[model samples]
Target: MSQISKVVLKDVDGNVLHPQTDAGIVSVNDAAGSPSNVQSEIQALREKQSEMANIDFFVNKGDVNSDADLPAQDYKNGWAYY
Candidate 1:
């Protein structure tokens, strides 16, 4: 098993934002003028963490059937010379 590391971040107010987990803590901060962006980033990170925790099965290219053909007329065949 791989060892997990802990990460911590504190704002000027001295609040502990992240805590250590079984794997470790990953901390990120917002830029000077973008608190909303930071919140969005944190939300995305939580989603990814949830996905990792609940992952059951994974499929690789080898598992796909190769007999499938590309759809016809999906795009133009020629490009402009310009």
Candidate 2:
């Protein structure tokens, strides 16, 4: 079953600018008024997380020679090597 949610937005003066409900809960915030922004933020966060997940810090060099040879010694620094 689907739920309903109520969302309200008030300015500094406590005046309601936007009042809305969806599903079974209510979200009150500036982004709540425009859920697209929230979705975009979520997507951006997910992308950032994915990017961070693929990061390899222990590698000596970014380039690998035939997978058997170790990276050059010059690539020792964590950031510099990666």
Candidate 3:
């Protein structure tokens, strides 16, 4: 009988997606050159959650005929639906 052994993960471009490890440990590469272990990744996500909690989501609700009907107002970081 054959037994399963080591495994290696890769991206479509053939880049190693996971950090080298000898055990069951895992890591996260949130972005290019931003390699972090599972623990640090969790911490970073928690911090981001806290920061996001303070953000206010504004929705510019109104009725419009089409995209051109939208007023010439700054809709940055906000949503507008018609």
Which candidate comes out best when scored by lDDT? Answer: 3
**Global lDDT for candidate 2?**
0.51
lDDT per residue, candidate 1, 1-82, as tens digits? 3334444666789887655332233334544454343345555577789998996444332222467544444433332111
Tens-digit lDDT track of model 2 for 5-56: 3446688999887665342233223334654433344545677899999987
Q: lDDT score, residue 38, model 2? A: 39
lDDT of each: 0.48, 0.51, 0.63
Which residue pairs come into collision in candidate 1? none
Name the better of 1 and 3 by TM-score.
3
- In candidate 3, how many Å is residue 61 off? 9.4
- Residue 56 error for model 2, in Å? 1.7
Candidate 3 C-alpha lDDT tens digits along 1-82 = 3222345678899998875643224656764658665555556667889999997676757778754477687776678655
Better of 1 and 3 by lDDT: 3
Which candidate ranks first by TM-score, i.e. highest? 3
Evaluated at residue 3, the lDDT of candidate 3 is: 25
Greater lDDT among 1 and 2 belongs to: 2
Q: What is candidate 3's TM-score against the reference?
A: 0.38
